[model samples]
Target: MGDSIGFNVFSFFFLFFLTDIAGVSPAIAGTISLIAVLWDAITDPIIGFISDNLRSKYGRRRPMMIVSSVPYAVCTFLSKEIRNLFYPRNCLRI
Candidate 1:
């Protein structure tokens, strides 16, 4: 679905930006990303399972969706942009 595509695309660009543009070593970037992907793999299924079984009055997934939507979008944008704009080396050399 559309949401899945957004998540996939954002994750791909996040990894690419980290390794390629953010000046992180490729090995570290890959390892970090691999760990994140594995964590996502584990968490997504559990979240989906819970959402599928919920019987809340406000709707099973709506609350989570609402709570996560803004933060997810904001963090994705910041993740892509913030790293390039300010790095530890730049900060420390000031």
Candidate 2:
């Protein structure tokens, strides 16, 4: 649930950041976002396979989830902050 919520929030804000704040054209922004979605589609199953095969005392997903949480949160926060700071207001006009 948390992961889904985070992804939703990031997806909403990231599109605005690209189109409005970063002054990217809507078409290009859409293309870039499409590429990211495609990459996720390609990588997710491979990552799942690798993690499924991982053997450890802490178990496969648990250790990776724990290790990833901090970095993921930090990166998400920093990325949003950097974008906000760099573009105080929306730069692109419709």
Candidate 3:
């Protein structure tokens, strides 16, 4: 749910923000967005397959959820941190 919302927000605002505010070229911004979208589309089905077939004691959903949370949180954090690191002047204090 949250991820879908984030993706929607990213698709809507992030290209403008990247090009206008962060000084990224439109081509680069588009590439970044395309890569993210493509990566999600590819990995989701693969992860779904792995999850459905897993025989863990904690069951498929719980184990996959736990395993995936680390990357989710890290990516969320790094998104902000990378912006701040490179474009501190443009970064808001959120």
TM-score (C-alpha, index-matched) for candidate 1: 0.66
| Collision count of model 2 | 0
Candidate 1 lDDT, tens digit per residue, 29-64?
889889988998999999999889978889998988
Ranking according to TM-score, highest score first: 2, 3, 1
User: Which segments of candidate 3 are over 4 A away from where they belong?
Assistant: 1-3, 88-94
- Looking at candidate 2, what is the lDDT of residue 50? 78
Cα lDDT for residue 62, candidate 1: 92
Report RMSD (Å) for each prediction in the order shown: 4.7, 3.5, 2.8
Q: Model 2, poorest ten-residue lDDT window?
A: 85-94
Once fitted onto the true fold, the runs of candidate 1 whose alpha carbons sit more than 4 angstroms away are: 1-9, 83-94
Backbone clashes, each candidate: 0, 0, 0
Reference-based TM-score of each model: 0.66, 0.76, 0.73
Model 2, span 1-94: residue lDDT tens:
9669977887888888788767799999999999999999999999899799988899999987988899998987886567456655664333
